[model samples]
Target: MRKSTASPAKRINFKPSVAKVIRERVDGKCSVPRCKNAIRGPAAKGTGSINLGVASHIYSAALGGPRGQGGMDNAFIASAENGLWCCQIHGSAIDKNAGEGYPPEQLFAWKALAEARASKLITDTPSPLGWVDAIQLLRFPHATTLPRLELSRCTLVAGVTASGQTSLLDLAGAVTQSAYAQRFIQREPSTSRVPFVEGRLTYATVDALDRSVDVQVLGDDIHRILEGKPCLLPPGDIQVIYTTLNDLQARPHEDDVAFLLRLLGVDRSALKAIANAIDLRLAPGPLRFRDGVEEDDHGVSHPRRTPSGERYVEAFCEIRTDELPAEVTLNGLSTSQQRGVILALLIAKAQQISQERLTLLIVEDLIVNFDSSKFMQLLAVLGEMPFQVLVAVPPARHNELLEECAGVATLKPNPDLSSWRLRWLGAPIQDSSPSVRRSGVQGSRAPIAKLL
Candidate 1:
C-alpha cells in the first residue's frame, strides 16, 4: 500500500456561475443597456496574471443547471455576452452562490444566495434560443473541421466529424428537402449548384489535420437548429457526446478517440454519465517500479549503497488544453491531467453539466503517497457527493490500496491465477455479511447474483 495523504476535498456545491472555456473567450457584460451584447479578451486564462470578469452559466443555477457551467450548447466556453464585468470578489460570491440570477440590483441578493442558494429553489423559464452565449461550441480548442449537425427530435446539435468534416448547416442548408432525403440522405452537391445556407451559426473548414481550427458564428438558422435536432441521429436513443481536450495533446489516432470514449463511458453515444480523467506527462523520464526496479531502463549498481532504495512515481504538473508544451517529460502519462480530471468530473454529471444541473468527477491511477486508509476515507466522503466519484489506482503497486477499496473486482484465471485483472473502488471496504472469498478458501460456498 502506498502512503496515503490525509488531504480531502471540502464538500463544495459545484457552482453554476462557472462558465465554459473558449480560445481567448470571455463573457462580456453589456457596456450597452438592453442591447444584450458584449465582448472580452478570451474564455481561457493565462497563468501569469488575472482576467477580471464575472462568469455566468448560459443556463442559470436556478434552472437545475450544473455549477461552473452555462448550458448544453455552451458547455465548453463562456460567451462574451453570457457574463458581466464584476470584480473578483463579486465573481467569487456569485460563483459560490452568494448572488442571484440574471443580474440582480444589489449585493444583498448575492449574500443571501451564497448562504441559501443551495436551499433556495426557483423554477427555470423556457428561455428563447437568442443569446449568442446560448450556442454550444464542439469542445475546447475548437475544431477547424466542418461540423455535422443532427436534426433529431427536439434539440439541434452540432460538432465536427471524428476526422473533422461535414458541418451541421452543410447538411441542413435545405429545409425544404424531400422527407426521405431529410431522414437519411447523403449530401452531395451537383456540379453547377450552390445552395444558399441559412443558419444562426456558420463554420468553415480550414485544414484536414486534427489541429485544424476555424472561427464559428451564431445566427437565427443556427438558433432554429439549436431549438431543433440537427438531423444528426435517428429517433429513440441516448447520445454519447465527446470533445477533445486538446487535439494536439496526442496523435489524432483512433486510439486517442478510444481513450476519450472509455473515459466518458459513452465512447459511442450522445450522452454519457462518466468520463476518464487524464494523467499529466509534463516531462518525460524513466518508468519506475515500486520494488526498487526501473522499467525497461535499468539502473547502474551503486558504488556505495544509496540511503533511499529508489523512486517510483513519475513527476508531473497539472495543465489545461492550451498549456501543453511541445515537448513532454514522461511516456505513460502524456496530456493535461488536470483538465482530464475536470472533464471527468463534468462527465459524471453530464445531465446536470450538459443541461447545466450538477457537476461530478473521477480520476484513475493517480500516483500519490497518501496512506490507503486515509485516502479511501476521503474517497468515501467524496462518493457521498451529489454528483459522482470514480478514482483509479494512482499507478503504483503492492495492491495495498486496491485491497482497501469500497468495491473490488479481480479477474484471476480460474485454474492457475497466472493473470488477473484488478479494480479499486477508492473507498474503504464496507463490512458486508456476505464477504467475498477467493477461489482457494477451503469450503467457501459460491455466491452470485451475477459476478459483475
Candidate 2:
C-alpha cells in the first residue's frame, strides 16, 4: 500500500490584476474574505521559505483540477478567486484534514464557523459580559531569519493563551513582519469600526476640522469639548485619517520636526522665521495668555491667561518669523493651538500650498479644559484653507474646549506591534562588575575597572 509522496516544484502566480485589487483592498494580506492578515514566508520560524503559504485550490485536482498535485504547471494556480492563502501551519493542517482518513468538511467548518460566530457576536448574539481573557505575543530564537510569524487578522487568532482561551486570529495565515504592520493600520478597528459592514469606511467632517462645526453630536465642537475634559480630548468613537503616506521612511520613534514640517510644505525661509519665534524675554513665560479675540493693527493678537492661570494665544495671523523669539509660550492655547502652530509654521515655509496637500488635523486628548471657542477660531482658519483636524483622548471630560480644538482620532492597540513576541537572543553574557554598588555612578565618578 505504498502511495507516491513526491515534491511539487514551486509555481508562479501571474495574475497582476487580481493581485493589484488584493493589494489595495487587503493591502498585502491573505485574500480570504474579511481576512486582513499578511503573509510571511516560513523563514520567520526557522522553516524554509518554500514551505510558506499555499495558493490552495478551493477545488481539488482530483476533482477535475487541470493538474494533479506535485506539478509546477500554472494551471493549478487555482486563480485568485478560487485561491486560499494561508501560512505554512494552516496550509499543512489543511492538507492533513483533506486526507482520505479525515473529514475535511468538519475541520474546515470550524474555522468558517468561528469567523461567522465572531461576526454574529457583534450583531445577532452577545458574548458573555463576565468572560475576560488576555493575549500576548509568541517568541522565537533570534539566530534564524524567520519573517515574524503572526495571525493575519485579529478576527481570528494564530495562537492561544495559557488559560486555554482560543485566540480570535486565524493563525493559519501568518504573515511577514512588515506587511502585518501595514495591514493592521489599514483595516483594524481604528480604520474600520462596523463589524457587519463589508465596504464601509469612516472619515471626519469639515466642521470637525474647524470650530465652526456645529456641536450637533455633543452640543459643541472640538474647541468647546476639549475645554471641559480632564485629558483635553473628546469622548468615545473618535478617529484620525491618514490621507497621505508621507515620511513612512522615518522610524516611528525618530519621526523628527523637519519631516513633519516638510510634509506641511513649509519654505526654508519661513521655517527659519518660525524657528526664530522662540522668545524668552518679552513674553518670558508661555505666549502671553490673551483672553480677547482682538488683533493689533497688523493682525497679531496678544496672549490670554485664564482665571485658573492656564495660558493661551492666537496663531490665526502671519508674522515676521525673524522678529519672533526662539521660545514664546502661548497661554490658554489648547493642544489644537500647539499642533496648528507647528503645522502652520511648516506650511508657510512652502512657496506654494497645494489644495490637494491639505488634510484635516486629528487631535487626541482635547476634550479637557481648553477653550472650545478659541480652538474653533484656529480650526476655522485651517478649514477655510479646506483642511481637517482630528483629536483623541481617554474616556473622560474636558469636551467643551477640546471639541472645538481638534478632530478625533482613536488609537487601537496593534496585535503585531504590541504583541511583544520574543525573538532569538544569544545567551546572556556575564557582567565583570563586582557586586558592590559604586558611588557617583556615570558622572564625576572613578572607573571601577581602574579601581579594581
Candidate 3:
C-alpha cells in the first residue's frame, strides 16, 4: 500500500488594503485599552515616515497558530473585521503563549472601545474660533468704558473684595452669554443705563488671514460685529461655562455624587480616571432605585406620586471618596475641599463633553483654602489643559499666581471717586510708569479661561 500524504491547512493573509483600513479605523493608534500609542510618525531623516503598528489577526490565519483558525472561512479570517490595530509591542505581547493572556472577547472589547474613541475625536473636534485677546467695558456699573484689557492664554485678574473681581468675571460670562451669566450678573434696578460688555475674538481664517470679531453684549441683547459691520448671524461654535465657588458648594436637597455622575455622562470609568488624576479614590456603592413604585393593600403595584401630584422615579449610586470619612457624606468635607471636588468634576465633564467648540471656562474663587503646593498643583493641571484659563485671585496672591500665569491684570479702585484702574503686570507694556504698578492684598483666587 502507498503511504498517504495529508494536505497542509490553507493559510490566509490580510491584504494591504484590509490592514490599512484596520489601522485607519482606530486613527492609527493601538487598539489596546490605555495603550493607544501613536504608531506612525516622522522618521529620523525626516524625509519619510516610520510605522510601528501592526494589523494583528484576531484569530490565526493557519491551524495550530496563536488563536487557532477554529474552522473559520478563509475570506472572513483575512478580512479587516478579523484584524486589530496594535503597536508592535502589543502585537507580540497578545500572541505570546498561544494567545493565552488575551482572549478573543477582550480583544473585541478593546477594538470597539478604540473605534468609539476615534469616532468621538472626529466628531467632537471643532474648528478654531480664535481667542478673546482684549475686552472693554461698555456700560457697566460705576464705569462707562475702561481701558482695553489685554488677555493671555492664562490671565490672572486680582483685586480686593469690592474692587470688581467678580464684576470682571461676570462681564466675561455676559460677553459669551454663558448659561449662568444671567443669574450671576446683577441687573440694574433703575434701567437708566444699559450694561454692555465687548470683547475682541481673534482667529485665523482658512486662508491664514488674521481676523477678529467684536462680540458685544448689551443688557439682554448679544451680537457679533466683523470688519466694522454687524454680522446678521453670530458664529454658533462658541461655548461658555461659568461656575462660581458658591455654585460648587453643595446645595440643599441636591445629591452631589449623583449630580457629578450625571455630569460625567454616567460613565464610571471616566469618573475613576478623574478621581485618579485628582489624587482621590472612588468606590461607587450599589445602585438603588427609590420612590418609583408602591404596593397597595391588595398587593397591587402603583406609581408613587409626590405631594404635588407628580409621579417621580429616582436611581442613584452612592459615590464614596477618600476625601471624607467612610461614614460621612460628601458634605462632611470642608468647604474648600467640596469646592475642589466640584471644580475637578466640572473640568472632567468639560473635557469629555465638548472638544469641537470654542469653550470658555469662567471660574471664581479657586485658590481659597488650598495651600501653596496644592494651589500650584492645580495651576499646573490647568496650564496643561487644552484651553485658555483666566483666574481671578486676590491682589495678595498675585505674586504666587503670576508665576504660573502668562500675565496679570490688577483691578484697583481709583484713589479718587473715579472709575477703576486696570494695570497689566508680568506682561510688557509700551509705557512703563509708576501709575500702572501692581498692588498687594489677601483674597481668594478664581480661574476663568477658555478651552479648545
lDDT leader:
3
- Over 1-452, each residue of candidate 3 has an lDDT whose tens digit, in order, gives 12213223777789999999999998998987557467898999968999999999987877677887655667677888788999999999999999998887677667775665566456432123334444544333334224445555455554423333454455555444443334423344334333354545453321222345565555565556665677765445444456654445433444444445543344656665664444231123323334456689999999866554566434333456677524323445555555566566656655543466555565555555565655555555555555555655544444543332334343333222122122342222223222312232222323332100
Point to the candidate with the largest TM-score: 3
The parts of candidate 2 lying over 4 Å away from their true place are 1-51, 59-80, 94-238, 241-305, 308-324, 331-452
Per-residue error (Å), model 3, residue 193: 10
Question: Better model by TM-score, 2 or 3?
Answer: 3
Clashing pairs in 3: 126-356, 365-446, 366-445, 387-451, 388-450, 389-449, 390-448, 390-449, 392-446, 396-441
What are the RMSD figures for all models against the true structure? 23.5, 23.5, 19.2
Indicate the residue-level lDDT of 96 in model 3.
94
TM-scores of the candidates in the order shown: 0.19, 0.23, 0.45
> By TM-score, highest first, what's the ranking?
3, 2, 1
The 10 consecutive residues of candidate 1 with the worst lDDT sum are 203-212
lDDT of 2: 0.28
TM-score of 2: 0.23
Write candidate 1's Cα lDDT for 367-399 as tens digits.
233354534443443333333232333323233
What is the C-alpha lDDT profile of model 2 across 327-356, one tens digit per residue?
A: 333333344455444444432321132232
